[model samples]
Target: MKRIAALFPGQASQYKGMGRDFYLQYQSVRDIFNRASEVIDKDVYSICQDEKMLQRTEYAQIGIMVLCIAIFDVVKREIESPIQFFAGHSIGEYAALTCSECLNFEDAVKLVQIRGTVMGKFGGEGKFAMANMGSASNDVIMEECIRFSDDIDFVSLSCDNSKEQKIVAGSSKAVKRLVEGTEDLFHGKVINNLGAFHTNYMLEAQKEFNETLCHAKFHEMKKVVFSNVTGRPYFDETQVYPLLGRQMVKTVKWRQTMDYLKKMNIDEYWEVGPGCVLTNILKREDPSINVKSADKILKMEGTGNEKIC
Candidate 1:
């Protein structure tokens, strides 16, 4: 069996009718959605089909994860290859942990619901915000953020998507100024829908969600998984609670995560999610690395879904 590294994507990659293919073709996909629906007390399958509802944080977080997990189940059914490692961007980590058996599917869904609800309550109506800036190096983004920060207003890097793309979050005024000042240098835009995640702007959310993460039962990983906070393999199950809690209020080391995977003897990299965000990031970092997406997974040799909706 070829050694494989599986990566799951986080929020913002979701779209209308993302996982309808899996739901229409596989019983296991519907089963996963039904299981998740019981935890959140809402119809997950129906939520995926609604574009306006999917934009909300509460629905988007859980909906994206459930779809990702459903696709992962399909991948496992079709391929028997060994997974060398597992990791996710942000909310994607819960999917990684659930697939690796660190946390059960129901528990992962519950945590995401609570996480989304807590964070969603804040940073709305222009109290705070996040922005994406492209064509600027990570150092330049950080340097500029520092230059814009002050006691009353500040901005911090939330995600290091790649060397050229970085995201910032903080007081609305600060983020606006940062984007406006750097617009001439890079493509910058304010994110109005989602809250400021992966920054101290989420401190309250982190505190509220920490209790749930600690309360959730975690088990020994059946496969190795990397940390978005540390950019290294999780030492063991003991680190899951603290690391996941800290992830809420820290920069996601995505660039570092790709660096760590390079050392491992990975034969194939598969992105099992609705969108190809992770796949695109890997290609940008190293075009030579062989990678595939769920769409291609459905067409793998000797694989076919018998049942159709």
Candidate 2:
């Protein structure tokens, strides 16, 4: 038997009508969306259908969580297999927690709603921006950013997605400067969002989010879940809140997380979410790993039921 891990994606994975097929096909999926709507007091179905709503941080966060959870639910119902581990990227962590029964769906939705609002409001206060640096070594990117730090107040690494891909977030002027300075050496593109996440720029939001986490209830994980902050399996449930809080203002150790998974000898990975972002990253990090999007699995197996399992 193969040990399967469930991977969830965070921001930048949401798309208009992302879960519409599942929403229409599965009562379980519809029930999840309905629950999400009741928890957030917003029409999740409509939100997923609207491009503008999918772009707002708050809406996007909740929308993606709901979709990921719905997909997970569908997979659980259809597959007779056991998931050995669960993990998520950034906001996707909430979905991972929910899937592992660490956090209830309603609590996860409400928490992410608050998180998105705080991050967006604080992130928009300044001209902060994020950019993807492709074909650049992490050391080279860091060196360039440091070289320009005198002019920029908040510029740092946001995510180390792979050996060759890194994300930087900071003042738009600083990011643009870095891009222009390294145009000949590396390819870079600005990410669509106002916040410079995983950096000190999110300290204010992190504080508020921590307070929110204090009141949030967490249950013992039923399955091992990796932390983006530590890039390791969470051994202590008590550390969940603090790790989630720190994740806001810390670089996402995604590259390390993938390495950890590889060490675990995970036989396969299922990206249980709206987009194939994490799937692509996993393939880039380790081509030998057997990974597939939940939707892709359904299609390849000729399941005919548009649901993921």
Candidate 3:
């Protein structure tokens, strides 16, 4: 039997037309979107269909998670293989939890709405994220963090795309300084994110989230799901609430998470979100393992190659 893996995308993978196909093709998917709209009090369907909605972080957050979950639901109903393990990047962890049945759909949507509100309140404009820096040791990254700590306040290591590649985050000014300072160290690229995340700057938001999660209820997971904060399996439903609260303030260990999946003997990695960001990372880390993205899978029309719709 194939050891299938499910991947979820984080904030950046969202787009205007992401879930429209699913909404048009399946009633179940349409119902999920409708439910999200009611719980979040936002028109998620319009948000997913409109380019203007992409500008708002709160709407984008809910949009990405809903799309990710909706896509996973579709794939689960269609695929016959038994899923071995589940994981998600950053915010995608919540999506994995919903998939694993650790959190109910309505609660997850409400939590994410609250999460987006708190995150926005604490992390204002001028905060940013950067991507595509060559992999340096934690010490090396820390040293750079220290040099710019006056301004940058290093937040988190977003993703470990490969042994030689990783993404860094900080405030916009500080990130700019780091990029200017390390131009010689990194020859690749440093693309910025929508805002500052996975850093101490978001502590206030985390505090609010801690209170919110403390009172929330979680169900025992039906399948093993990994945490972005710990890069380990979620053993108890109680621990999930706190882990999420601390996740914003902690660096994401994407490399370690993938390592754990490799240890679990994951035969194939399937990215069940709108984009293939995680799939790209898996390929760079180990190209031999099968990596498939839901977008590619759904777009294929009885052919192995991706098709345009």
> Which candidate gets the maximum lDDT versus the true structure?
2
Give the lowest summed-lDDT range of ten residues in model 3: 300-309
Per-residue lDDT tens digits of candidate 3, residues 31-149?
88999998877788888877767656677788888888887877887777977588888889889889888899998998888887787677784566665568677777667766875
| Cα TM-score per model | 0.91, 0.92, 0.91
Residue range with the least summed lDDT across 10 consecutive positions in model 2? 296-305
Clashes of each: 0, 0, 3
lDDT winner between candidates 2 and 3 = 2
Residue 220 Cα positional deviation in candidate 1, in Å, after optimal superposition: 0.9
Give lDDT tens digits, candidate 2, residues 1-309: 778889999898988878877887788889989998998789988998999888788788888988899889877766667887888999988999999999988999889999999988888834778888885777788898887666446578899888877999988888888777778877788875557888888889999888888899889777899899998889867879888879999889888888888888888889998889998887876678798786433443565534353
Rank by TM-score, descending? Answer: 2, 3, 1
lDDT of 1 by residue, 1-309 (tens): 788888898988788988887887789989999998888889999988899888788888899889888988888766668676898989889999998889988889989999888877754534778888875777788899998889888888899878766778888888888989888886689876376788787888889888788889999877899889998889999988888889989899988888878877688888988788889888987899888887422444576544211
Looking at model 1, the pairs that clash are none
Error of 3 at 49 (Å): 1.5
Q: Which ten residues in a row have the lowest lDDT in candidate 1?
A: 300-309
TM-score of 3: 0.91
For lDDT, candidate 1 versus 2, the one ahead is 2
Over 4 Å off, model 1:
125-127, 135-139, 183-193, 295-309
